[model samples]
Every structure is written in C-alpha cells, then in structure tokens.
Target: MELYGQVLLIAMPIFLVAVLAEMWYGRWRGKDTYRTMDMISSMSSGVTNVTKDVLGLSISLLTYTWMVDHLAVFDIKATIWTYLIAFFVLDFQGYWVHRIAHQINFFWNKHAIHHSSEDFNLACALRQSISSFVNLFTFFLLPAAVLGVPAQVISIVAPLHLFAQFWYHTQHIDRMGFLEKILVTPSHHRVHHAINPEYLDRNHSQIFIFWDKLFGTFQEELRDVPPVYGITRPSNTWNPVKINFQHLWLLAKDAWRTQNTRDKFRIWFMPTGWRPADVADTYPVEKIDDLYGYVKYESKSSGALKVWSWIQFGITLLFLMYFFGHLGTIKVPGIFLYGGFIFLTVYAYTELMDHNPNALGWEILKNAFGSYLLFSTGDWFGLNHYFPQGLYLIAGYFVLSTLVTAWFVRKGITPDNFVTQATKSQSYSTLNTH
Candidate 1:
C-alpha cells in the first residue's frame, strides 16, 4: 500500500510538471480557450477512465500475486541488471499484447474502450475494460512464471512500468526531438490514439518506441497528415462500465444476428466494428472526423477565476497526496480507507468526465457504501493486525472522504454544466441553419 501511495506521490509531481509543460506549449502556440470547460471535461474524464484501468490492473495483480506465492519461485539476489532485463522483456511482451489487442476481435472488444475517446489525453490512456485482466494475466505473468522469475519482482516491476506510462497519454506535450525517435512520447502516443487510417495500429510500444520501429508498426506524426483522435465509433459519455463493455455487447449482438458460424467468428476476431458482410451492407457507416472535437458550452469565468480554479485543484491534489501517504503507513484501517478513497475518487471523476450533473446521486450512494464498510468492518478487512492503533485511521478516512464529497457536491454541476449547454447550442444552431 505504501509503495502504491509513493508511486502516486511521484506521479502527482510529474503530472504538475507535465501540466506546466503543456501550458508553456499552449502559450507558445498562441492557444488559449475563451471557454475552459472542455479542458475540465477532458481532465475529469481522463482521470475516471484511468482509475477504472488501475482497478482492473489491481485485480490482475492480486491474481498474479497468488500464482507467484503458490509456485514459490521468487528471487531476491538478482542484480539490478537482471531487473532491467526483466523490465525490457516484459515491455517487449506488452508490445505484442497491445498489437494483438488492436488486431484480434475478442481482444479488441475490450480494448476498444480505450480508443472510444475522441480526445487523446493522459486520462484516456487509462480507459480500458475490466475484462482486460485476462490479457494482462495470460500475456505478461505466464512468461515470467515460465522463466522462474519471482512473484515479488513481477508484482513490483509491473506497477512501476504502468505508473511510468501515465504521463505519455496527454496531448499537452509535443515531440521530444531525438528522444522522440527512441522513447514513446506524448506525440508518439497521440498518433497511436488517432483513428486516421495511416495512424491506426501504429506505435504499439509500451515503455520504448524501439519495439514499434523494429516491428514496422511505428508511424511518425506528420504535420501534413493531422491526426484524428478516438476510435472509429465514439462512446456517448463517461460511464466506466458502459465504455468498457459497449463493444462486447455490440459484437455479441452482431454474432447472434449472423447466420453463418464463420461470420460470427469473424465478428469477434476481426478488427473492431467489422460486422458480418450482410450487416455491414445494411448498417450505414459514419466515420467521425475529429474525436476530440466535442460540443463546448461557454464558461463565465474570467482569466483570474480560471487560474483560481486551477489553484484550488492543485490544493486538492496536495491534500489527496498527504491523505494517501498517511493511509499507506496506517494499517488495519488502511483497507477501508484505500477502498473507499478509490471508489469515491473514481466515481466522482467519472461524473465530472461525463459532463452529467446527475452524478451527484451516484456519489452519495458511493459515500453511503464507504460509510457502511468503515462502520461495519471491525478488522478493516484484514489490515487490523498490521497496526497497533487498529481502525482509528479508517474512522478518520471515512470522515475526511465524507467531507470531501460534501464539498464536491456543493460545487454543483462542475465544468460539464457548460458543456451540456454548448451541446444544446449546437443543436439549436443546426435547427436555425436548416
């Protein structure tokens, strides 16, 4: 838990650095929004999506931990060089996993959630299906187990690799020049996120761009060919479950409707959105042009006010970091605290991302569940023995989380409120033009 907390602590500072980098880039490019609602929407949604991905990865970690423990093949004496070798090998394996995810139908169904965003941002990088656990387990851990790598090493290194990739998801950063030739930067990744025909299935590297170049999957971002972000099909909103499973359901329906077995198999195995020939003929295709282009409602905030909002967000992030740090050291109560914090954070961020004001009810329900867990679970679900103080930390976390949610609710509809208005305005404009 402390390790995870530390990773997040490290990530926050990196995130701030990335934000500053982005701001500088934006200013250099002479880009400033009269309305910052879109920025808020993207940030909020990206965070929610990443949270879901982390939760899914956590489950996979638990399974991997159990397997490693059961097999008893851990190594403590391995040098730093060995760990480095393992990291590259694991990442090399990830490249194929990522590639197959794009190529194979069943895998793509789950992976499609990540591509659903029209906007390429750091948060969107985190949007993946819970079912992706199957791929994570089978592709990465199985090989390590075969090589007699210890479970402890795999467990530690896997998250490290994952956490390292978080900053590469944003559109805020540009090409890293010579480093961009070798390492996967924001620009390199943004190209991968693009739906442009030339961009699709390119740049499949996780930690290093060398794999993509070696495998002939690398496509450098060209100014002449402006990248179009998002999947071929766009998701309606930021509902995590829906985003994750929408393609699965679509494929299942397509398979069921197809009379031929081969067609059914193709529907599940081929690239995403490939239906049976008969269905494709009947279903009109609408290829979206700009994935990041969404209806933006206006914001009334002045420049000073916008700066103030960002400052508030920074403060909130600082508090969250401290809170997570404290919770890491405190056992017994840590379980409830960790779970409740994650649940609330993911839930709130999801609502904020979707631009839906109605998410308040869901947030309330989440808090209610957290309260129930803390009050009812005496053991903090098995962490009690770790700390001499026991569940006091749990009680404090519960109160703090509750207060935070109260404050979030008090802030009202958030930036999404303006987004909804922009959508309405677009609708009205269309009608007037007609």
Candidate 2:
C-alpha cells in the first residue's frame, strides 16, 4: 500500500498537469471538450478509486503468485526480456478483461464510470471504478503464469501498463498515421469511448490495437458517422460515488420487482444493459435515442460556486496526498479512517455541485465526522506533526464549508434557479468538436 501510494504521489501530479495542458490546448484550438463540473466529477471519481486501492479494499479471487506457483511449466528470470514478455501478456490480459466488462451485465457496473462522461478529455480518463471490489479476472494472465513470470514482475508491469493508457484519452490529438494500426491511439480510444451505434463496443484493446482486430471487435473511425461520447443512459448527477453504483442499484431494484425467479437469476449474467421483459415494460429507464439531439447533463453553477467547488476539490486532493505520503506512519486503522474522511469530503462537495438541497445536510455530516476525528484522535490523522496549526486550519475550513453550504441552501440555490441566473448573466456555449 505504501509503495503504491508513493508511486501515485509522483503520478497524480503528472496526470493533473496533462489534464490542464489538454484543457489549455483545447481552448486555444477552439475545441474545448471539458466542462467544469464534469471535470470535477471525473477527478472526484479518480480520488474514490485510488483511495479504495490505497487502503487495499479489494479481494482477488486468484492471485498471480498462486497462479505462477501451480501453473508454471518453465521458470523465467526477471530480465529485460521477462519485462517485455510480461508487458505483452499484460496487454492481452487487459484486452479480455476490458472486453468482459463491456460484454457481461454484472461486470458493466465495474466499468460504467469510465463511459459516464458526455465529453471526452484527459480528466474523464481519470474516471475509473471504485465499485470493482473483486478482482475476478486474474486468471486471464494464465499465459504469463505458465511461463513462470514472477508475481513481482506482474505487479510492477500492471500499474505501468495502466498509466500508459492515460495519454490517449484526450480529444486534442487526432489520428497518428501508422501508429494507429500498431497502438491504441486517440482515434481508437475515441471510438471505444463513443456510445454511437457504430462505435458502441469496438476497439477494446489497451496498448496493442491488434487484439481488437484479432477478436473481430475493431471498428475504424469513419468520416460520416461521427463519434458521440458517453453511455446510452445519462448519469445526471455530479456525484461519482452515486454514479459508481447507479447501475447496480437499478439491477437490484429490477431483481426485486420481477415476478419470475428465473428472470431475477438470469438478469445478472445475461448481457450488458439487458433487463427483464416485464420490468422493461413496467419501469423503463431513460436511454438516449436521438444520439445527436439529446441534451447533455448540466447543473446551474455561478462563478462563486465554481470557485468553491475547485477549492473543495483541491483540498480533498491535498488530504489524499498527505494520506498517501504518510501511509506507513499513520498505521492501519488510522489510514482507513483517513480514507473514509477522504470519501466523505468528496461526497459532500460533489452533492453541492449537483445542487442537491440535501447537500447542506451531507456537509454537516462531513464536518461532524471531521470534528470527531480531530477531537478523538487529538489531531487530523497525525497532521499536527507536520504543521503545528494544521488541525486548527482544518477545523476552520470545516466550519466555513458548513456555513457556505447552509447559505446556499437557505438562499434557495438549486439547479433550476441558479442555472437560469447563470445563463442570463453569462453565455456558456458547448463546443462543436464534431
């Protein structure tokens, strides 16, 4: 956990810089693809995912060590050749795992956050999954395990392989001539992210473009059928935690509502987005039909609110960095507590971003929890050791956050009213990237 957290301390900043650079490049090119709230939502999703990972809040059905121990036919040494082979096998493993997430009904919940953004950008690339509690696809590395690749080698290659995919998530880059055929370029990824009928589930490879080609899921970007991003059903709210489980919640409700036991049993593994026939007719979920004409999700945000949201996001990020940097010092339960606080910070601010009236309530709850931690632990998870007055400042921030949230709530601030006011004051136009 400490090792991963330390690595993230270096990686996260580079990612943020890349996202900011992409935003700047887009504006300069007159093709801005990022919305403020959307970017925050995406970043918040990333925070929750990383926090979950850093805290080791997952269970793998079969570990790589276990696989290699029993399945190896030949022992391989950790050389340059070993890493190259590991990278190749990891790419193949990523392809099938990614394809499964798109194909199966139950697994789609683990991946839906990635496709939730209507606008594609580097920030949206950060929208990974927190709902994937079980690592069910470890056996996909059978080839590597059989070749006696060390578990340490797989562990090292896995994160590097994941980070390598981050750059191609941008809309700023066009097709990369010959590289498009060899690697998953920005063009290939755009198709993978698009919800248009033509591009629904094509291009499932991570690094190698050949996997999709070999598997018959490859669809080239066409001139006429422009890519339309996001899922068929819009996740209207700005809360990433809520978005992570929205599909699973629907599935649970459907299972309970269905009369046939068989339907309940079959719904989970049937196919992605498949609902029982009776449930579909009785309780239909909203899905996009006119791909070009459907409205994108938006919430009313004044300049001040946007500024406050950024502050909240920035502070939450700082808290995460502190936790990551001090993992070994903070110890077990302390680290878990800090992780919980991080989750609450994200949930509270994102609720405000969604303009939910209950946001104030969540803020109060967050402040209350933070206060308890401060009083009971005698510091903000050992932050006082770094700065003498750090705890006091955190206390002040909590008090200020609660007050601001209450003021917003009492002023009748909601998506309905605030958006109207924002529109009359300033015209915010969606860029025509197509």
Per-residue lDDT of candidate 2, residues 274-297 (tens digit) = 999999999999999987667677
- On the 0 to 100 scale, the lDDT of residue 407 in model 1 is 56
Query: How accurate locally, in lDDT, is each candidate?
Result: 0.60, 0.89
Which candidate's TM-score is highest?
2
TM-score of each: 0.67, 0.96
Any runs in candidate 2 off by more than 4 Å, and if so which? Answer: 415-434
The top-ranked prediction according to lDDT is 2
Clashing pairs in 1: 46-123, 74-150, 105-269, 118-291, 118-292, 122-169, 332-383, 332-384
- In model 2, what lDDT does residue 298 have? 75
